[model samples]
Target: MSTMTVKRAELKPGEVLCSYCTARCCRYFALPIETPETWEDYDHMRWYVMHGSCAIFVDEDVWFLMVYGDCKYLLEDYRCGNYEDRPQICRTYTTDECEYDNDGTYDRLFETPEQIWEYAHAVLPPKKKKKKKKSATEVSHQKLPIVHI
Candidate 1:
């Protein structure tokens, strides 16, 4: 994609500039991963993060799992439809300090499933549990037995 550049002030010049960007950051797809304390949780995240276009990022104190996608209003030229009344967050955002600038500044950034798996494995040992099998007689025996006094 061609990088479109505008003056630093032009980033938030009135509402038009923000609208022009069409809230690209907010529009991108993302979901939160439940707190990953256990290996299984991290393993689940590994599968999720490995899918095409997927990325995991953390900001401030929160973790976000994301997939890259464009905004519905991002025109062929990358402009917004309603520039005048764009959301306040977009209006206030400055490209000077943005993802486009630093790419992303997550405290921890996991770019791939392998990266997540490695982190999980390094911290947690691989332990698998065996499933217990129950036969029909065993199942019936566990039920309340008839009391014939």
Candidate 2:
């Protein structure tokens, strides 16, 4: 995808964001997640990535499950439909420091379950299977008496 670059001195921050054709910030949302350490944790993360438009990313040791979907308020022209009554989070968001400039800052990213699973296998130790010994009853062919109700 081609990114729009503008001369910072010529336009204000709002104008810079407005001139950008694609609303990169509104295209996705990320929820912070616990770092996967165990097989089960990684398995759950794999399940999350298996869903459509879902991905796992790690930025600065913090993990997040990124869901790729356009914001409901975002219009076709890359503008917020409810700019006047936008949410507090949106109001506080500044274009000067946004994801658009540092889209590739993630330390690690997993777009698919296979990728996460592979990384899990690489980092986690292989599970050891214990051999079960034969029971005394099976070896001696002896059975316990059954109680009648």
What local lDDT does model 1 show for residue 30? 68
Model 1: lDDT equals 0.69
Score each candidate by Cα lDDT: 0.69, 0.82
Q: Candidate 1 residues 77-108, lDDT tens each?
A: 66666668778866896665655434556787
Point to the candidate with the largest TM-score.
2
TM-score of 1: 0.58
Q: Write one digit per residue (lDDT tens) for candidate 2, span 1-149.
A: 22557554566644654465477788999999998889999999999987879899988899999999999999877888999999898889886767554646579989988999899989999966778887987868866689999
Question: Residue 41 CA error for candidate 2 (Å)?
Answer: 0.5
Query: Candidate 1 deviates by what RMSD?
Result: 6.1
Runs in model 2 deviating more than 4 A are: 1-4, 7-14, 103-105, 130-149
For model 2, give the 10-residue run with minimal summed lDDT.
1-10
User: Which lDDT value does model 2 have at 46?
Assistant: 91
